[model samples]
Target: MAKQRKIIHVDMDAFFASVEQRDHPEYKGKPLIVGGQPNSRGVVAACSYEARKYGIHSAMPCSRAYRLCSHALFVPPRFDAYREVSNQIRDIFWRYATEVEPLSLDEAYLDVTYTEAFNGSATLIAQAIKREILQETRLTASAGVSYNKFLAKIASDMDKPNGLYVIRPEQGEAFVAALPVGKFHGIGPATETKMHNLGIHTGKNLREKSLTELTERFGKAGQYYYNIARAIDERPVRSQRIRKSLGKETTFAEDIHSIPELTAKLLDLAERVFESLSKQNLKARTITVKVKYADFQQVTRAHSTEHIIQLTDLKQIIPLLLEKTEAGIKPVRLVGLSMSGFDVPVLQTHQPQLDLALNDEF
Candidate 1:
């Protein structure tokens, strides 16, 4: 018999911002912006739902957000506090399932298909977990329950500030089909604009296009669009999935036309690339620059280096990599930097995750 799939995506409600409000009761019911200072060219970390009502959002310039909602309470980041709560929440997760994969400090996916709780319906488990979360954390979380990772992750966002949303198998594709194209996971501003220009303004519009049309329009993302539009996602809820690569991508709010501007963007991208990869010990041999033009056509340029890349090398070679693709790209809508082909260590490596998984075996 084919095993039934049961996955849950648990996302903390306004993780950082909520933590601040929880710690300081005065911050509750008021607009709060948490991150670096507004004058320091800082961006929004996370804002209270109250601030969201004022058009303030994460990643917005704190200065601009200030202009929009001057009364909003502003505070510097408290990573230490958030990290502490994150550990507690994770402990709560491990009690339910060992196959837990964290998307970030505040979100994770749990596949309870084979857990002791499996005999129960996913919705019942979802409710049980939600009640437990409220009791333990005194914080709200939104949950999505479904058969696969894709839908479950998206479903979790359906209800916010303490919600449990379930998409039963029967609803499946029909549910996704009813959603707007902009609603698909990862359809950021640039992709949304491209889809609108391509006459795919909603999920139904995207569905009307053939697989070939989507693939031609959005490159690799097109495949994801086609399948997810009909809720056909099959990806497993992988736990401690060895991250093969860590990379960063950027989408410009405005398209770039000039060489100097493009080059500067590339440098900025490289800096971000190095910053992200620097935190991990993973070493990679290839660096790839991904570009999407204003017209939505996408292409990549990759070069293999004999030695593993460091921040210095990434910054130094970014311009050269741009030059290699100079003939093909223009008026860029988005640009991304990625590295791959990690060199595996020979001897016994330290994967603390294996010990955790083994401990769960008994």
Candidate 2:
């Protein structure tokens, strides 16, 4: 029999808020919000547990959050500080696993199937890492241990604000079967609604549907659902996954209908994308512009050039792309710019085949 893989998923609890609380002792035990000023047109990036009590959460409007808890302290993000702490946490991950996949600044997956630590116990490894994170950063983290990325990621969220959970291979199927489809790591609200419409509220209900039926409804993602329902995910814990694209978007407080206003916003976004490309020492041949109308209708237009794109080219191309959308005819609520088709060589890996699907939830 082949050796079973052991994977551990670690996620810092309320990372931004925790860091803020730890750095400023005065904010400890108080409701804190991170991301924009309460009066500004911004959303919550992260909030402390105390803030959650009032129903304040990430991505919520800062204005709504203020209404919920007027006394809550609001602070802007400090990315440099977060990056420095992330490096410290990753250094600890390397001590226990050779394959460490960082999902973000505050979360990662570690494969320790062959390590000698704790007699190859993934649970012990998780505990040790959490202990070390607390000791070094004075912050708490939650961990999940399982045989695959899907299960491990789900297990990590079973508890919150500093918790650990594990799922063994023998228990994987039953555990998944009993779970709500919405609780699955990769499943999002839209998929959950579709599943519910099909009378598939739980994993067992999902498992009852044929792969063909699922694929017919969800396209390629159906196959992914079928396998995870059976506790089968063959995606490997990749150590070096290269990013294929980079982009950023901004939402306006009020909708704009004039071409000049839209062009000005696009200019700012283009500059931001160009700065990122320069910092990464990368160039691209494709530029995509995304526009969202006041009615919440969104459209994306892409322009490709034989030669690599330059900052000046973006400034010129954006105005042309805006014509593809009803930006001037209908008020626009958001505008974004992105670049891909990099000049750098791409990385390739021979991945194990099990399910060819992904979670668009994030």
Q: After superposing candidate 1, which stretches have Cα over 4 Å from the reference?
A: 244-280, 286-304, 310-341, 345-362
Question: What total of clashing residue pairs does each candidate reach?
Answer: 2, 0
Count steric clashes of candidate 2: 0
Quality of model 1 by C-alpha lDDT: 0.78
Candidate 1 versus the native: TM-score? 0.75
1-362: candidate 1 lDDT, tens digit per residue: 34557788999999999999989999999999996565655579899999999999898877789899988889998999988988888888877764788888899998776556634466766777778877877888899998888889889989887988888888877888788777778898889999899888777788888999989988998888888888788876666556666677766666787756776777777777666666676778888888777766778888888888776776567777777664234677677888887786643322123211111111
Candidate with the greatest TM-score versus the true structure = 2
Q: All candidates' TM-scores?
A: 0.75, 0.92
| Candidate 1 worst ten-residue window by lDDT | 353-362
lDDT of 2 by residue, 1-362 (tens): 35578889999999999999999999999999999889887789999999999999998889899999999999999999999999999999989985889999999999877666777788888999999999999999999999999999999999996999999888999999999999998899998998899999999999999999999999999999999999999988887877677888998888889998888888888888888888988898999999988677899999999999888886689889998888788988788889988988766654343332322111
For each candidate in turn, give its C-alpha RMSD to the true structure in angstroms.
7.0, 5.0
